[model samples]
Target: MSKTVGVIGGGQLARMMIPAATNLGLTLRVLAEKEGEPAALAVTALGSHLDVEDVLRFAEGVDVVTFDHEHVPQAVLRELVARGVNVQPSPDALQFAQDKLLMRERLAELGVPVPDWARVVSSEQLARFLADHGGRAVLKTARGGYDGKGVRVVRDASDADDWFAAADGEALLVEELVEFRRELAQLVARRPSGELALWPVVESVQRDGVCAEVIAPAPHAAGKVADVAADIATTVAEALGVTGVLAVELFETTDDRLLVNELAMRPHNTGHWSIDGSTTSQFEQHLRAVLDLPLGATGCRDEWSVMVNVLGGPATGAVTDRYDLAFADQPTVKFHFYDKAPRPGRKIGHVTAGGDDLDLTVFSARAAAAFFDN
Candidate 1:
């Protein structure tokens, strides 16, 4: 019998999973947030992921439950597990991703390399942390922050007064502002049965705190750096008891050291290039991992692959309207659209280009992605 996999959120991640599930002959069901959300077309049911009754109905008959996003409430997830549903990356491991303070505390216990950080419950506490960290620090809500939201760089306590006021006396997290040479991402997929697969460590380019591009097998990542990255990712996966794809976002310092910046237990934006540039896409590997199937090879298809996100631009128009131009200009570039309306800075699509030369591949992808900007 074909096993059914239920995804708890309807976003681009779930949308991308449709093709992989179809190819694997698996049934893919999504508990979409809205009637016509990005992954709605691929869903078997429609409802908010937060609704216990609705989620219970969606999980009925599904062999395993996964996620498109990590925002699902812990109460709802725990309820599902209590009901005997198979939830990969169980709530115990997921709480770290859901709450940064918990993540830092756990990583610290494991002796993981992380930046200086502290938990702050008041403006005075934040001021003390900032004083210890060069008088400037990054403050983040322990829960519910992404894409530059709920994060701020503050030079003094007054800078974060609003965040403190909004927290209703709840504690927030503060960390030293990292002075890194560049950002790196390591993606690892692990199965319930202890099988693991790893992809090359890649360089991620961020603009205004949002990832704009990724270069597979990061430039100049040769011996020790690559090995340490892989080791860190592997260790993190085993330590956290994470199943499915786990993305470890790291900061590669100028002095040649690595620091754990963040963690995402899902097919991440950094691995999006694997769709056409790897022997196996992260989406496919994620499914195989959750289902406890033998993993696929993680080799790159070309010497270099560059993925540039096609963020919504100033001019408003459908992504398809620029496809003809993009294809005609760069036939080798591969485009993946998420059936979303264009909005400034939103990720509506992406273009991946691979070849023997990194510069040319990057140029190709950027050109194709830029065509949509107008």
Candidate 2:
């Protein structure tokens, strides 16, 4: 029997899952906000994920419900569970991804290595934390923050006055500004029945708080770094009862210590390279994990896979307009574009190049992505 998986967002992540779902013979359905969404190819219903009626209506007849983004309201998720809908990575586990403050509190209890942080609701509290942490801190709204939004670097308490004023009486999360050598991301998938699979820890490059590039297997990360990253992800998965893909973003500090930075419960930007570089893509693995199917091997298809995102594409034409030049210049590179209108600082697509020669592979990806730059 074929199982139908319903995704709650119609973004590129959901769009990318369509081919994986087809290969696995699973039916893919999406609850999109409107027409022309990237996942419009698989959309079965058009409604707001925030609305109880819309989400409940989309849940009908699907074997399992998942998400493209974590912005879905907890009340809606719990309601789905209460009504007998199988929500993968249940609201209990999903909350850690949704609410940053709760995530910090729980990770601290679990003894997960994280940055020094505090919950502050006022400038006085923020001022004290700043004073303790060298007059500089990273302040973030506990919820609704992604891609650099709702996050601020404060040199003084007054820098966060606006966020505090708009926090809805909620304590925001503030942490010591971490000094790190580089950023790394670990991707893992766990089934409800306890089986788990992990991919190689990869290095991620962020430009203006958005992922711009990824290098698989994280150069020079064979022993302790890889082992620790995998351990951290496994511990979090088992403890939180997470099902489907979990991305743990980490900081490899200048002090040689790895610290947890952020968590995403679904397919993440860092793992996007696996779509063309691994034995099994994260999207395929996610479907398998959510359905309790046997997971696939995560071996690399190449020694080095470099993925560069196409950000802020051409100002006038669509992304496809540049394919003519890109395809000719980098034949070995794999290009993927989401059907989204170009805007400043938006991720419109990505190109991946994999080979034993890291330099050539990196160049191929960069050259291909450069074609799309405005």
> What would the per-residue lDDT of candidate 2 be over residues 265-306, giving only the tens digit for each residue?
999999999999999999999999988889999999999999
The residue pairs found clashing in candidate 2 are none
Evaluated with lDDT, which candidate comes out highest?
A: 2
Q: Relative to the true structure, how large is the alpha-carbon lDDT of every model?
A: 0.91, 0.94
Worst lDDT run of 10 residues, candidate 1, spans 313-322
Off by over 4 Å in 2: none
TM-score of 1: 0.98
User: What would the TM-score be for candidate 2 when compared with the true structure?
Assistant: 0.99
Give the lowest summed-lDDT range of ten residues in model 2.
160-169
Give lDDT: candidate 1, residue 46: 82
Residue 76 lDDT in candidate 1? 95
Error of 1 at 292 (Å): 1.0
RMSD of 1: 0.9
